[model samples]
Target: MDHLPPHPGADAAESRVAARADAYAAAPLLGCLLREVARPVTDEPGVHLLPGCGKLLRVRGGRRPAAPEVRTAGGWHRLDHAELVKLVAEELRRHTGLSNHELPAEMADSRDTVAALLTARARATAPADPYLRSEQCLLTGHPHHPAPKARGGGPAATWLPYAPEAHARFPLTLLGVREDAVVEEGDCSALDALGAAPPGYRLLPAHPWQLDLAAAGLAGAFADGRLIRLGTTTCDTWPTAAIRTVYAPERDLFLKFSLDVRITNDIRRLWRHDLRKLIRTDTAVRAAFAALDGPAAWLSDRGYRTADFAFEELAVLVRDGLRGHLVPGATPYLAAGLVEGFDGSPLDGPADPAAWWEAYLGRLVPPVLAAFAGHGVVLEAHLQNCLIACDGDGVPVQALFRDAEGVKLPPGTDRAAGWERLVYCLVVNHLMELAEALAERHPGLDPWPAVRRELARHDLPEIPALLTAPTLPAKTNLLLRWTGADGAAAHYRPLPNPLAGA
Candidate 1:
C-alpha cells in the first residue's frame, strides 16, 4: 500500500485522515462481526457478547455499522481500525481454534486501499452522469464482507489505474488472434465490430489490467505469430462497479474480461467450466424472462471469445447494453449503487417512501421467485446483478438482470440447495439490504412489510414458510474469507428475519 500524503500540511489533519480511513475500513468488518460471530446481550440494539472471550462489543447500528468499541476491566476501550482488526483476529482464533494470518493482513490492506482511494478521489472529479457516478461511488463495497476493497494485496500503483472507485477509465488493449487459434461460443460477433482485425484473425479486446497481469504467459504467443497487437480502442471505456466488466457508451455494449486479481471471495477470472456452461445458463434465463409478463428484462450474456491455449486468461464476455432493454423513458440505475449511494439516488428521498418501496419490491421480487419456482432457473438476483429503472418521479417501473455466469439450473443444482441460494440472493442479499438503506433514509417507514406483501403475492409454496420463518440465511463472508473456503460454496449463519410477522 502506498503511504498517501496527508491533507496538505498539518500533522494533526494527517492523523485525522488516517483515523477516517480506519473508520471506513472498520465499518464493514464490524458488520460482518455483528452478523456472523457476535451474540446479542439484550434486545437493546448495537450491543453484542463475543462468546468465550468475555468481552462486549458495541457499534452504531445501521446498514454499514461503525464506531466499534469493546468493554474492558478498567473502562470501555474505543477501538481504532488496527485495534478492531486485532480484536477480530483474537476473537476468531479463540472461537474457531484456528489462526489465519492472511485475512487479518487483507483486513489491513483493505483499510490501506480505502485510504489510497480517498486520497486519489480528493483530487479527482466525479462523473456528471448519475448512473456512471453510481457505478464509481462504491468506496466501501459489500457491506458484510471484511475485505471488500482489498486489491489482491497488490501495490496501489498496480491496481489504482483500473479501480472503478478512483473513477478511472482507459482504452482496452485490442488483440488479433490467429483464425485457427481463436475459440468462442454463441454470438461473439459483437466483438468484431469494436476494432478491425488482420486478414485471418478475429478482433478481441482485453482489459489493460488483465493484459498486464497475463503479460508473462502471453509472451510465448506474441513470440510466435499466433497473436498480434492491434493497439487500443478509439474511445475510453468506463468500468462498472464490477471492475472487470466495462461499458462502452459509444457502442452501447458491455465487455466482461478475465481479471487475475481476487476482488472479494474469488480470483475473478472467467473460468473455463463456467464459460462452457454459460450458453445453457443464459439461454434458460432468456426463456424465463421471455415467458414472464410485463417489462422486466434480462441483459443476456450474448457470448464470449478467447484463445485456445489461454482460455480463462484471455476470455471476454459480451453482454446486452441497457439502451435496448430499458423502458421508454426510465433511467436505469445499478441496484447496488442505490444501496451504496451516490449524489442522485431514488432511495435518497422518495416521493412516497412506502409506494416507492412497494414498486421496487413488486418489480424486483417476482421474476427471481418466478424463475426459481416456475422455470427451475435460479437467477443471482443480488443487487450488483440487477438494474432498477425509474421514471421521472423516481418510481421504479422496470427491473433488468444480468450476469449468466452466476446462474444455476436444475439437475446440475440440488433442489433444496438451489432454493437456499434464491432466498439468500433475492431476500437476504438484495431486498433486506435495499430495505435497510430505504428505512435508514425514511425513518418510521418499514420496508420489510412491503417486501412481505410482495412475496405473499407470489403463489410459490415457499412463500408461506418464508413469511413465517424465524431466521434468514445470511452469507458468512468474513468467516469464509478467514477460513479460505471456496467462494462459490456459501456457508450461512442465521439472522433475525425482518419479514417474519409481515
Candidate 2:
C-alpha cells in the first residue's frame, strides 16, 4: 500500500476534504497490530473517488506486504489495508487538542496491534450483519445544515424538520457540512416556542462521513432515552448505526421525521391513529385482509428491506406497526417481534410454525375465507403480520391480527385516505412478505392458489385472479414469490414459482 503524509497546516486547503474524515481509533479499539494501519485519505469515498469511494485495504503478505487495491463501493468486498496513517493523525489531534497543525505522526508503528483488533471486530459483527468501528475526519465544505442536497441525483430528502415537539429542543437538520461548519453552541438553545428541552436530548449535525466516529461512542448514550436518538430511515447521516438498525433483530420501527412542515406524510400517518376509521393503519390493513376471501394472508412489509446504509434510495420510514403491543386473541408467537427490515425491528424471531400456525389448508383455509366473506373486512388477516393463534399449548385457535397498522378492504372500492392506505398497507406490503415466506418455506403449498381457492370457496369476488396467467417472465416470478406475492404488485410478475415436485 502507498503511504503519503501531507502535513495538515502546511496544506490546510489540501486537507480540506481529507480533514473532513476525522482520524479514528482502529477497529477493536486499536485494530490488529500488524505492520501498519491504512487510514482513509479522503472522506466521501464513493463520491470523492469519483467513479465512487472505494474500499482500499493494505494487507501484509509474508514475503511482501500487501498493496492497496481499490475496489468500487458498489460491490467491493475487502478492506485489508495496513497503512492507515489517519489513525496516527487523529491521535495527535486528540492528544494535543490541535487542528490540522497539531496532528503529528508520532512513534509510527502501531499497526500489528491495530490491524489484528480491527480484523477481530470486523469478524465479530460479521454475520447477516457485520460490525463497523470507524474514526472521523474533519472536512471542509458549504453545509446546508438542515437540507443537504442528495448526491448524484434525486431531490434532497430533508427529515427531522422543526416540529411542535421540537419547540423545546432545537430541531437540528443535518447538512452536508464539515467540521468548521459546526458553529459554537449551534444547537444549544431553549426555544420560547417549545417548553423545556428534554434532559437527555441534544442535536449535533456532522458531515455524513463523521457518523461512524459518532456512532462508536454516541450510539450507547442515545439508547438511554425512552424515545432515544432517532435515526433517518436513510443511513447517509451515519452508516454504522444505520447498518445496525437494518440488521439488528431488535428494533422494528422507523421514521424519516421529515422536516419540511409542508411535507407532512409521516405526521399524517402518525396522527391518523386518532381518527376512528383510520385509528391505525395496522388495524385498517388487518380488517382489509380479513375481508379478503382467501387462505393467503398478507406477509412482508415494503417498508422493511432490513435497511441498507447505502443512502441511494428514499430513507423515509413509514410507521405502520407498534412494537411490543400484544393482541390478546393472537398467539404469543403472533405477538412476535418484527425486524424493520434493513430499517427496523419489531419483536424477535418469526411466528413459530409448529407452535403458532393452524393445521393444514384443508381445515384452516375454509374458516379464514368464511370469516372475511362474512365481514368484508380482512384487517391484517394475512399470514405474516397477523397470527394463527392457539390457546396455551400449540393448538391453532384463531387468526388474530396483531399489527393494527394497516386494515384491508375489497379492491375497486375506494374508501378514504385511511382505506386506500389500508389497501396499500395490508394487501400490498404486508401480505406480500407472508406470501414469499410461504413460497420459500413450503414450496408447492401455493399461497396465491390458496388465495384464489379461498375466494372461490367463499362467495367473495374474484378481483385478484389476474395474477396467475402464463406468459409472465422469470425475474417477475422470482421477485413476486420472493416478496411473498403482495396485494397489488402481485400483478407485475404473474407467474408463480412452480410448486410441483418439491
Candidate 3:
C-alpha cells in the first residue's frame, strides 16, 4: 500500500494508483530477468548484478518481487514501469546484441492494459457466481511472465471488450460453413445445438475478435458463398482467464477459438499440427483419468470444426464442461484464479488451514503423477490448466485438468525431459503457487509439510529424489522471450525446493 511521494505534476490519488499498477506490472518481468540474466550478489540481501543491463539492481519481496531500484553514483534510483521497460530492453539488446522493438512495445502495452483493467474493474460489479468471478479475477496473470497482460499491442478499445480481466461477456458470432467445406473430427455435435444453420450448411461458433482479425483471410470464402454469416448466439459466453476459451452457461459447454494474439508466450491460435494430434492426446488422458480411483477428472477437448480453406484461422475446439465431469455437490474453481486471489477463493475461508491444505494436496497431486507414471502421459497441470472442485465447506475434493494440446505423450518424448516438465508444471508452477497463497492468508502455518506428506504417500520412483533434491526447475520466461526462442521450447533455471528437507 505504501508508495513513494507523488510527483509535482501528478494528482496524489491517481499517482498512487499508477504506482501500484506499475509495481504489479514490473514485478513478474523483473523476477524473470533477475533470475535468468542477472547474477545474485550473495553478499547483499536483495541485490543482483545485472550483467545484461550493465547495472546493479535491488528489489524487495520474493516470488513477485517489487520496488525495483538501480544503483547509481548518487544512490539507488527507483524505476517506474517505463524506465523498467527501457532497462529490460537495454539488457536484452546487450545480452543478445539484437534489438527487438516489438517486445518492448508489448511490455508497455501490458502495463497500460493492467491500468485500464484496474479502472474498469473499479467501476464494474464482480459476478456473484464464484466460478465466473474466478474466471475474471486474473489482474496480473502468470506471475513470472513479462507480458502476461499484453494483447498483441492492440488498442484498449479493441481488446478490452473481450478481456476476461475486465469481466466482459458477449455472445458468439455464429457462422454457417457449407457442409462440403467443413472439416471436422470426433464428436462435435454439441456445437450444432448452439445455433441452427441453413439448409446446406452447419453451425460454427467464432470468437468475435478472432472473426474480426481473420476478416481479410475469410473474404474469399464469404464472397464465393462457401461461408455465410448467421446471427450471434442467443446466450452469452463467459470468457475464461485463457482469453480465447469461453464457457457457455446455458449449454454447459466450453468452446475454444483460434485467436491470433500472442498471450503469454505463443500466438493464441490452434495450430494445424496440434489439432491433428489432439484426438490421440485427449483419448490417452481421458483413459488415464477413467482408470484413476478418485474424483479427479479430465475435461476432454472432444473435437474441432473449421472451414477447409481457413482451417487454423476458423477452428473452434469443443471441450467438456462442468456438467458431467464435476463431482455431484462440488463447486469447481480455476486453480489459476485461486493463485490470482478472488473474493470467494477457498484460501479465504478454511476453518482448519492444515486440514484444508492436506485435502487440496490429496485431490490435486495424485492424478497428475499417476497420469505420468502409469499411463506415459505428461499433463500440463499448471495453474491455469487445472481446476480444483471443492465442497460446500471449501475443502478441495477433486481436480479437473484440461487442454489436450499441451499434453505430451511418452516414447515420443524423452523420459527425463517429460519428468522434468511434469515436476515443473504440477509441483513448481501449480502446488508451489497455491501453497504460497495459503501461507500468505495464514502466516503462522507452513503448508509444505502437508505437501511433503502427500508426495511421500505416492509410490512413484521419482518421489524419493524429488523429496531430497536441493532445487526444482523454474521456467525462464523472460530470457526465452528476449532471445526470441519458440514459446513451446521451455528453458529453466533452478529454484530452491521447499520440499527438500520436509
The most accurate candidate by TM-score is 1
Q: Ranking by lDDT, best first? A: 3, 1, 2
lDDT of candidate 1 vs native?
A: 0.89
Model 2, residue 481: C-alpha shift (Å): 20
TM-scores, all candidates, are: 0.96, 0.30, 0.96
Q: Per TM-score, what order, best first?
A: 1, 3, 2
| 181-253: candidate 2 lDDT, tens digit per residue | 2222111221111122234433323222224323454443335432233333232222211111111123332
Better of 1 and 3 by TM-score: 1
Q: What is the lDDT of residue 443 in candidate 2?
A: 38
lDDT of each: 0.89, 0.29, 0.90
Tens digits of per-residue lDDT, candidate 3, 1-502, equal 8888867756865776698789879987886787678888999989988786678989998557889899999999999999999988898899878878878888888898898888788778887789989889998899888888999887888888898998888999999999999999988999999889989999999999999999998998999999999999999998999999999988999999999999989999999999998999999999998889998999999999998999999999999989798899999999999988898898898999999989988999899888887898999999999998999999999989999998999788877899999999999899888888888888898888889999999898889999999999999998788888999998999988999866
What stretches of model 3 exceed 4 Å from their correct place? 1-14
lDDT, model 3, position 446: 88
Q: Which of 1 and 2 is ahead in TM-score?
A: 1
Model number with the top lDDT = 3
Model 1 regions lying over 4 Å from their true place: 1-13, 43-45
Instruction: Look at candidate 2 and tell me the lDDT of residue 424.
Output: 33
TM-score of 3: 0.96
Better of 1 and 3 by lDDT: 3
Winner of 2 and 3 under lDDT? 3
